[model samples]
Target: MTDEHAPATPATPAVPATPAELVRRFADRLADLGLTEAQAATRAGMSIAYLRRVLDLGCDFDRPALLRLAAVLGLEYQELVSGRPEERLHAAAPDADSAPLVGPPLLGELTVPECWTRLGPGGLGRLARTGPDGPVVRPVGYLVHDRTILYRTNPDGALAPDANREAAFEVDRTDPKLHEGWSVLMTGALEYVTDLALLAELPQPPAHGRWVRLTPGTVTGRTIRTASAR
Candidate 1:
């Protein structure tokens, strides 16, 4: 009888597989093809003796034989061997322009340090808020690093009142005319840094950017870019 405490099987769901598992399963399936061992060996481009030797010794055929066997079995060679989309097998490595997108309006979430890191030296983020009054958006430069986010503002801007509170920031790069590009949104608690000396040391200035520290409580974000721009 089943043990009541036995872990239940998980619900059926799509899953990704690792490479070695693919190789082992393929070998077992090859063993059942409609052919004698000698015939299978010959078609797989191996000497019957060598095939029998490996079989007796319990080793699967090497990659070359597996590849030839796949061909004889009408399989897509690259997909079976590399475990990636056959289309990508011939394509260059993924990048901003060639990568498949996660999906449209790619909604996702990720944890970050108290401060968001530099998106790059040129990265900028926009702060948006919906208070008891309503919604507002403003572009701001950021000096992000481990454990803290830094930036300059009115020191009493719309976002200041929301400091040490929950809020969201968004950064996006998209081609509106052609309806492409990506957008990223981050949500978290916002904390304002009041130490003037610390703010004085932050790296912010396109000439006059100042520093303010924000200790993020939690960060959840997602990226949405073109599939072509992986």
Candidate 2:
């Protein structure tokens, strides 16, 4: 006999490898939705304590309960159980200007914190500087630590910026097929780091000697995406 208090069996979409995996994916999906556990449980017409027991303890949840949670998270019944999203990953951006266009683009800005989150550590970005000859831009590998940009170059090389000089650094990515892309620009005064203690903690490459830092005064970013994506 069916228990009248039990929820109806939700649509089974995909099965997860383990109960823990399913809970973790559900939590991630909830985070992506910007929902709290209580909020999600309330929306799914369940008690907070019971939801917590299931999610935190990795206890088995009935199919009906799973369906309600999936609906609340805006995920396919199976996707809620699977740790990975249904979307496929794409290249960061095209290599050259000659790359074919996918469609007309829509543009938007990313907040400073978001910009830093995207920049992360050890990625390629262009450093712009003003030289006696003229303005110049060159590609460099950069790391973001404590919200400061750090890079390495030969002290005598053109890649090295003079301390106290203003500079601009940029990084961007695009997905032509998805008609989506973003660009981040950081402007700051370059400071050659002299603190041995701090330098020792940073990434040390045997081939590179001089390590410099950019303390950004301005960080601005823009994103372009297809209308459908929003």
Top candidate (lDDT) = 2
Every candidate's lDDT: 0.47, 0.66
Q: Give per-residue CA lDDT, model 2, range 48-162, as digits (tens).
A: 8877666654425566777788777655565565532212111122232344555566677777777876674346789998887888888877766689888877877666767
RMSD of each: 20.7, 14.4
lDDT of 2 at 183: 84
* Top TM-score prediction, candidate number: 2
User: How close is every model to the real structure, measured as TM-score?
Assistant: 0.40, 0.55
Candidate 1: misplaced stretches above 4 Å?
1-118, 163-165, 175-182, 203-210, 225-230
